[model samples]
Target: MLVSRGQQSTLLNRVKIEGRGLHTGAPVAVTVNPAPPDSGFVFSRTDLPGKPSLKACPERVSETSRSTTLEDANCRIGTVEHFLAAAAVAELDNLYIEVQGPEMPIMDGSSQPIFSELEKGGRKKQEAPRLWRKIEEPVFVREGFASLVVLPEERFRVTFVFIGPPPIGHQVVDRERDWEELLPARTFGWLEEARELREKGLARGGGEDCALIFSSGEAAPPYRLPDEPVSHKVLDLLGDLALYRPILGHFIAVRSGHSLNNKMARKLKEGEAGSNARKMFADN
Candidate 1:
């Protein structure tokens, strides 16, 4: 009895981008290829000779400390959340992401570039409608001060909450979903964390240009919007939900990050206990 929405669309053609990872700093070239209906989103690592490919889904998420990474026991790709977000926002169901490195170029540290690329690729509707995974019940999770609460809703929606040190101190975001409002939210980091990352040679590629860096709790560039942090969290959630393959139910976030996001994603996919909401409203 569940119905989907939107027409399945992909690039009318292929488009490509070459850059460096925001974290790994590795050189990378990623090509976006339009796919057939119901193909879903798939990432192929052309850099690997064997040409290992992984489906962009919660089950494929192997790591999420910095960004959502999709992988399997044999192969993997890192920091793909933004690109995936672009795909989801566009409501494009089928895509082939061919990459030559571990991370997609951190271009502007937002989904802007990816959005441009998606447009360049073009869109064409298929015969089928985009199915939605409407939450029939609520799914919740929490860790310390961070928490995630997803409740059943008629259409796709997201709510975000963030509370940390200054600069990003705290914020909340609420909206139905729009490309303009969501696409502009950029990635941010603290100065000390950025420095430590550099010393450890982890996110060496990350800098002021790719990500907004706050120094000692000061809004480095000043926030584009008051609730930018929460907006970005909503943005992250959108990208992650794209893996769900259709319209998603309501998603809520409270002081949550990639770690908790991935955990919830995995639980949804695995249908872990309490993850289902059928019983909650069964009688209603």
Candidate 2:
């Protein structure tokens, strides 16, 4: 089991990254800076007028096709799962992310670069206690064959079962202490779907360097891990869960993606709110 930290933390210094969006293929720059306690994770669209900002929360998730996207009345941000996953693992409670484009840079199509940058910037504990949430009862969400469930646990854990065609038939990953292994696993896709996805205005920026592409029911040599695709699924799940406060539970996902993950997060947050309301009424 993982131990919880008593105090909140933020980056000690600012860090910047520049790359191309995996879907938009547009060049972008991102700067992550430390923020005051309780600030949570906030994103600002620096390229747009007024520099509109939005907090990272489950309710703000507006899109989840090929990636998780957040939007508000004034602005929208796409492909944020990688960065958010890194922050969750780094235990960063407060951060101000400034993006100079509509989508986040898909650096190497993995969370390793982002996680490394955050570590290089260092971390410092803040005065306030860390915001941790736990469920007293199981929270579950499902859609057809995909499902996600969170059960009460003393520490955070994730178990993912990936189901796909051909090259990515079926794979399972159970992660608890070895988060570093998941960071290096890059996003993947079938080579056969490249043209179709591009025609739909997606994966325009994707390339062999940024993603693992399989052809003729076979992936190229040099796999990052035994089952890299499944590991990436685990990474994406953690990022989606980050929308709510840090949770203490064992999350089990089967054929789940961003949409299902976000639904589970909203349910978990709603359950916590209801529990708090009951406690407040009893005290009154």
Candidate 3:
């Protein structure tokens, strides 16, 4: 079980990473720096004028196609799940991300690269206590065959079920495994989808080096773990949920994608707002 920390934390040192965008194929550079307490995760577009910034929040999410994208009137950022996942697991309370392109660098197609950088930067505890959004009641959301539920729990946990075609058959991942085991699991796609994705102006930077390509009933191995794809689904789920405040709950997901995950995040944020309002009224 993942227990919540009592105090909030941020990076002790700044870290930088450079790579190509997974979808845009554009060269991108990111600098992760520590922010003041309660600053949360803020992404600033250095490539744009005035360096417009957007805080990582469910209401700011503009797109959930294949990946999560955050946008505001002045700037936009794409494919942020991997970075957010790393930050969440690291228990980082505040960070300022400076982006030099439209999307985040898709390093090794997993959260491992970002996680490693966070470790190198080290963690520093702040003065304020962590603002954890504890699940007092169950929250559920669904999209077609996909569904996600958050139940009251003492610690953070995720159980994911991935159902796909042929070589990428049925797979299930539960809380038995550690979060580190899921870090190296790369994103994946069918070999046939490559061309179509490129034609549609997506996955331009994707390749065997950055993602696992399944062909002829087999994934291009060696595998990072037993079921890498399912592990990645869990990673994505955690990242999407990070849009809300730190949570203490058991997340059960079934074939849920970014879209459904974002919907659940928005719901949680709304619930948190209502909760805070009630507490304030009672205190008054």
Candidate 4:
């Protein structure tokens, strides 16, 4: 896909979508409205009084379990990665997302739905040049068997590895495919984990329809694409990175999830700060 160059962008019109939340099981109505350039992606809780808003940034990430959640003083937005991933791929720089519930609708457990909506809504370029974080050095994080590594690159790219139990073993995907190629890859969970999550008041609205359920000894549902699970992980990483400015780097993630992904974002943010500081001192 051709990356949007030079100017920043936002939706040209307001787009609305309604569906059931993955965890809340309650219906939600979301309106994606255009905002002035440089505003970044922000969320507003319309169901609550005062309509509190929260910026979608790595610093505001409050939860990174099976999904990513953001929080402000008293407002929270859950399961936001899929939506943010779509926005990133669309090269959107500013948006005001108003939600009528605590979480976004599962929307087939992939980013394709969100991308389609944004495509129909259209995009408009702004006056300011789009900002980007270009990694000049390698940065990495490791925990147990998982790891995330960022290397300097001219464009954003990702390589992800997913390792699951039987019926789904180790899978590796290396590519710079466009969002359209990866957007339909659905979030997946082991059958046991899915049941436990539901018992803990999560994934209440999830079923075989929205998410892929894997079993220890049974077959996985027909895949939308080869290595769909790992592709979805790549999608999640893209969404997490979208929390900050677009990155010009290559990411290598192995057995990683949202927690590690968010940690990488924090590290990258710190790296940017440090780089700016060094440049300032050198100029003096």
Q: Judging by TM-score against the true structure, name the best candidate.
A: 4
Clashing pairs in 3: none
lDDT of 4 by residue, 1-284 (tens): 11235899999999998888999888999999999988999899999999999989999999998899999888999999999999998989999999999998898999999899998999998998787887778999988899999898887788888887778789998887566799999999888888998889978899888998898778878999998988899889989989978987889999988899999988887777787777678779
RMSD of each: 2.9, 2.4, 2.7, 2.6
Query: Cα lDDT of all candidates, in order?
Result: 0.77, 0.88, 0.88, 0.88
The CA-based lDDT of model 3 is what? 0.88
Clashing pairs in 2: none
- Model 4 is weakest, by summed lDDT over 10 consecutive residues, at 1-10
* lDDT tens digits, residue span 73-147, model 2: 998999999999999889898999999999999989889999999998899999988867866568889999999
Q: Would you give me the overall lDDT of model 4?
A: 0.88
C-alpha lDDT (0 to 100) for residue 153 of candidate 3: 87
Error of 3 at 148 (Å): 0.5
lDDT tens digits, residues 202-266, model 3?
A: 89999899988887666456778988999999999889888877788899999999999999999
The residue ranges of model 2 lying beyond 4 angstroms of the native Cα positions read 1-5, 219-221, 278-284
lDDT of 3 at 191: 78
